[model samples]
Structure formats: C-alpha cells, structure tokens
Target: MTSGFWQKTGKGLAKTRHFLSAGLGSIFKKKREIDQDTFDRLEALLIGADLGVEVTQVLLADLKASVERKEVGNLETLRDKLKTSLIEILKQVPVAPPIDESPIVTLFVGVNGVGKTTTIGKHAKRLCAEGKKVLLAAADTFRAGAGEQLSIWGQRAGAEVIRFPPGADPSAVVFDATSAAMARKVDHLLIDTAGRLQTKHNLMEELKKMTRVISKQIPNAPHEKILVLDATTGQNALSQAEHFQKAIGLTGIVLTKLDGTGRGGIVVPIVQKFSVPIIEIGVGESPEDLIPFDIENFVGALFEEENP
Candidate 1:
C-alpha cells in the first residue's frame, strides 16, 4: 500500500482509534500496577468499541495472564500487548490462496446496501490498472437498476459488463458471462449478484444456482466468494456473516465504510467467527480508497496517536 493510502486508513479509523485510546490512554498513563478495576475498565472499552463479547473476554484473559507474569509494566508495554493480541486474532484467518490462473472468477456477495457493487467496481479498477483484461457480470437481476449500477461501475473501471434484462434469470447471466470470459480469455471475471437478505431462502438458492452454473462452464470456478460487509453495522454484521457463510461458504470478506463507524473493532469478531480472510477494506468513496488488508498496518493505525 502507498503511504497516502496508509495515511487515509489511519485517518479513516480516527473514530475507532479515539474511542479506544481515550479510555486506554487514561488507564495506563501513570504506569501503575495492574489491578481488577483496570481490567474492568479495559473490558468495557473493548466492548464499547464493538470487539464483541467473546473476543473481548479472550483479550482480557490474555492481558490478565501477561500482567500476572509481570510481562506488562507500563503504558507502552500494555499497548504493545493489546496490539499484539489483536494481530494474533486477525491472523487466525489464513491468507487467501494465490490467484494465479487467468480469467479468475470471483463472486461478490452480501445483504442489500452493503456496498457490494461499489466494492466490485473498486476491485475492477484495481485489476484494470494492472493492465489485466477484465469482465464484469451483472447477475443482480432482481433489483431494478442493479444491472445499470454495475454497468456504471464497469464503465468507470474501464471494463466490459455482461447483463440481462432486469428480472431475468441471474443464473443465465452468470452462464453467459462465464462463457464470454472464457471466449475472450480475460484475466478476471467478476460477477455481481443481487443483494438478498441471508434469511431469504429462494434468493439464497438462486445464488447457489448461479455458482453451479459458473462451475459447469469452468470447473472449480468462482474461485473467490467474497462477502462485503458494512463496518458501521457492528454486531449485526456477524449475523449476516453467519447466515451467508452457511449459505455460500465465504472465501473472503470486504469490510466497507470503516471511515463512518467507530466500531471498526468488529472486524476481529467477524474474522474470529468465520476464519475468512479480510481481503480488502474501504475507507473512502474514491476508487483508490479500497485497499488490501494488512494486519500490521491496521493494528498500527488503531494505536497511532493523533497529531498534536
């Protein structure tokens, strides 16, 4: 990632950082001995930041053990321990396997209004910038204007979009797009599916049908099933993940709108629950704002002090 992007990420996480640091900085400022009251405050701070209950407890337990072992003695030490613990939790989700094959097929999935289409556009823009031949499939046929929205994004990203009439079979759209991708021998084929509530049985079945169609054209295709989630939704995002994961089996996650929420710590629980790598994050609206997830940089940004 570029330094500019890194700076933007830090700036985007300002709310979450402030939410965590304000309490933590005060708790550790004097470097006093660790006590139960200190741990209680820490627990509240973590929970308040939307780390989720289980993850918060695990972190607190680790901190308590470290303190008892005399491993954390000062503000800097405590901060370092916290950062390390978070990184460890995030790293549990193994990195996605390399995409080495041509015409790499990826399905972007999520509930309605999670910025799934926008994320596809940003990703397409990134791939196009690398001079790769890219094709976008507008299989989101249920929503009126869904195809048009993907088309707009495809145009902006300098990629071709394959679509059918709204209300057409989304599976048909996927099949044709898969065939076109193979015929054109493009470097990437990104399919955009309708945003359906995870609880919607027929809609979810349609998603599975689309997947089957792609596989018929290209074996083991739809190489990546990515879930785009809104960071601002906090714990609700977890329910979406649970239902979607059971429905389609997520290969990756894209956390969007981090800049709009102080509950960025929600990323930890999502990863812990699903063990799916967070492939990208959106900190702003610009196409360039979608950046790859880097554990070290993310943790650093969370603890990075604000400029005086």
Candidate 2:
C-alpha cells in the first residue's frame, strides 16, 4: 500500500519550494556574469537560505566554474543544474530496506526532544497499516512517562509495545522485545531509545548496550540506526549530528519539525558535511505527516512557484 508522506507533504513541499524559489530566483534575475558581484550575491543568498557555509562555498565554486564558461545562462539551466547536483548528492543514500521480512529491527537515536519517540510511533503505525506485524520497544527508560507515551502509541497504531518500568535497564527491555518479536515472528521491531546529550557517556553507553543486546537475538539485528533531528534547530542540527554519529554511528537522519519553521535548508548542510542519508522528514505532528526525503520532490517543492 502507498504511504501518507506522498499525500500530506504538500505543505513541506511548498515551504521548501518557497525557499528554493527565493534562492535560484535571484540567480537568473540579471544577465549571467563571472564577476565577484555575481559570486557574492549567489553566495550570500545560499548562506542566507541556511544551506550552511561549507555547502554554499562548494556549490558557489561549481557555479563559478559554470559561469566562467557561461554554461549557466538563465533560470531553466540554473534550476536544472541545481536539481541535478542535489539529486547526485542525494542519490548516495540508499533506499530503505523493504519491510517484507520478519523481525526487522530499527534503532532510533538523537538528542532530547527531537521527536524520536513520535517518529517511532508513526513508523509503527505505517508498518501496521501495511499489514505487517509490528512491535515497539520503549527503551527510553530514563525519561518519565516515555514508556506510557509509547504504550499509547502502541494502542493508537494497533501494535504491541514492550516496555520496562522507568529507570529499568534499557538493554533488558530491548532483549525482551527482540525475543518477543522472534517468538511471534513479527515483521518489524522499532526500538525507542533515550534522548541524551552526546556528551553524556552514561547515556551513550546505554545505546551501545541496546545494540549489543539486539545482536544476541539477531546478529547485527538493529539494521537501521536512524537519528532524529529537529529541523528548526538549524545549524545546531549539524552539531548534534556530528556528536550522535560519532557516538552511535548513524545510518540515517530523520529531520523533524520541517512544517513549522523555514529552516528546511538544514537538510543541505547536514548531508553535505556529514554524508548521513536523510531517510525521512517530519512535516507535522499527524501520524501521516512524516515523509520520505525525495530530492526532486524537495527541490521541485522548493522552487515550483517562482522564476527569474
């Protein structure tokens, strides 16, 4: 069955399109030039667009080369070139594994309050609707009410939730959950991890334990380690990504809160600097609001309305 992202991402698409339109819209305003003024304008626009300094510089350097050769002339060529470059960059992220197999485990990690738990719930619901047997492990045992919240989501999503009392050993919960999943032959096992600062060794240790415990049941069972990030955090998102990746090794990133703020450009720098695959974006709070990251749809959504 088709997912909800393809349907409700229109608003996110619009937000992204609006930003992209503003960025590329200016590039074609005047006759193409190889002068420093042209370079400065483009650079400033991208940086202001929140693409980050490094990404802006790299993109600007490439644009400079094209301008010197007069390869980028008008709006059409500029838009196409931008889209192609972004697509090439995004193509590096492999498509997520299909969920047809049983007992697939996904470990969710990120800093506090990045919507990690909510993302897990949404994912569980989606998998359930697809007719897959899904289970949720509330391994975020350090936080108060985290277990109950996940249990609520379990009921809402119609999936079983395995949780321990607050302050219980998270690894034990995961160990039990994995065993339950295997015994039931479930399709997917999504583990909700604690949201701790990357600097916290104890919390990071907990994550490593979660991974180690899962390995016991299914070798390298946590097939996907998704880092959920707050898009509204902007550049702070990059720092969080760096720390989280270093600590637990992020397999992908889930950018949350894209629907509220205009800071969607965080996607560019996060990918450019870290090379972490952006698997999904949280546009809004609805269970259906999380969208798979699509470069073209994203770029098109960012620039659909305006032209130079």
Candidate 1 residue-wise lDDT at 286: 86
Q: What shift in Å separates residue 121 of candidate 1 from its native position after superposition? A: 0.7
**Predicted structure 2: lDDT:** 0.80
Instruction: State the C-alpha lDDT per candidate.
Output: 0.90, 0.80
Tell me the number of clashing residue pairs for each predicted model. Answer: 0, 4
Candidate 1 lDDT tens digits, 122-163: 999999999989999999898999999889999988999999
lDDT, candidate 1, at 131: 95
Instruction: Report the Cα RMSD per candidate.
Output: 1.5, 2.7
TM-score of each: 0.96, 0.90
- Candidate 1 residue pairs that clash: none
Which ten contiguous residues of candidate 2 have the minimum total lDDT? 1-10
Model 2, residue 16: what's the lDDT?
57
Q: What lDDT is reached at residue 197 by model 1?
A: 89
- Looking at model 1, residue 245 earns an lDDT score of 91
On a 0 to 1 TM-score scale, where does candidate 1 land against the true structure?
Answer: 0.96
